[model samples]
Target: MSEFAIHSILLGSAFSTAFFGLFAVLNAVGQIIQRVMLLRTPTWKRVYQKKQLDTRPKDAVDQLPWETWRLVAGVIGVIALLFVLWGTDYVYGSIFGLGAAYVPSFVRRQMKDNARWRLRLEVRDFVAELRLALALNVTVSQALEHIADRSGQVTTSFIERVRYHVERTLRMESPEKMLEALAEDFQSEDLRKLLVLVRAALRGGMSLAEALAQSADSISQNIVASAELSIEEMPTKLILPMLFALFPTIMLLALIPAVSMLITSLSGVPGQP
Candidate 1:
């Protein structure tokens, strides 16, 4: 058999072994986590059962299991590994495979970060609008309904969710508790603080409009500061990529001719076969 064919077979076998090994490890870890959860929290089994029994329609993001992205990343990594192996050598292929495996998670994290930032801005606008609505001498619920009616798409879903929970448990639960629970779902500190201020206003602890205006101003300032900090740190964030990717390529390109000349000169200098 030709050497290239042997090399291809070896690469294929190694890829298959690595892929299955990774799968087995992930599966085992998931099983362990499930078992631990079930053991430590008896309600976990009930929660899992309830989720399985629930028949509500779900979005694409909700329908997929958490590990689905990892599987997709693995597939992409395998494809990248194969392509690199065919085009180059094992070292580059391995490096690229590992990097490819992390791309899905990195992209997902970046997307979530962007969505959270947008939500924070939307919450700021919502607080400002709520203050305006309250100044019109309406009840808190009426003002919320008015704002919900006019809210942009980003805040509409959140406001609608709050309205839904409030209406669903109008007699059984306090609106403040429902609002706080919904805010906690988003897991935004700014949103939580805004909700706390709104709750305090609802209980007549402070002036609603003034508290909301202050919260809006604070959120606006925070947003501006976050933007400025991101801008200031942009070069620092870029340094690692330049060092790992661009710098190496540039250095290799710059050194190749010199290394070739040194090899040629050394070859001519002595009988160093």
Candidate 2:
């Protein structure tokens, strides 16, 4: 209705058109750069992540060396956006780009947690199988060969590698060394410690049953402690946003009108003064 309101609407419309125009140019430039990279054979292959001749998921997308290229392209996009708009607009673009970049990392973190849990469940059965082999007076190599034969069992590959490597150690006359190598290859803290214990037991002629039992117990306790610690710390870590951000905004929403009324009442009480 007023001149001020009319001018404000016009300014808003101008800003919207300018923003959309910049976005259109940015989108076109991004597509052009992508196509240019796709022209060269190596560059095209890097962006697309084509698999090798051997087995693996065709769409796994393991294009590693292209990471540098992606980073460069991202930097270029942000710089272009900032120049086209302003420094303030760069913040918006950065926040959006960062979220897109970290989507894969966040998904991988969750997947790793699930993978660890699956591995732990399988390890429980594995420990039981190993104990049974020990009870039957079967050598470690014999037990592992039996484990490797269990088709569709995910742990079979690891067991087969260890069994094959250990068998080679038997010919070389260094079983302890073989155990050490197994620990390194497996990349497992529990397995590495267990191997160290195995070496010590072999050297000192300690009871094998006692060593295996202790290792299993130790691993289970560590898992329990880890779970407990995570649970306890979660509330403390979670309070921050609620305390600093959400709580204040909510409180202001509830109190702002009442506070304004109180201020008006106090200001209007001037006749008594």
lDDT of 1 at 203: 75
lDDT of 2 by residue, 3-98 (tens): 332233234334444544465567779989987866655865664564332222121233433344344444544444443344222333333343
TM-score per prediction, in order, is 0.65, 0.51
Once fitted onto the true fold, the runs of candidate 1 whose alpha carbons sit more than 4 angstroms away are 1-24, 27-66, 75-95, 151-160, 169-172, 247-273
**Candidate with maximal lDDT:** 1
- The worst-scoring run of ten residues by lDDT in candidate 1 lies at 55-64
Candidate that would win on TM-score: 1
lDDT per model, in order?
0.64, 0.53
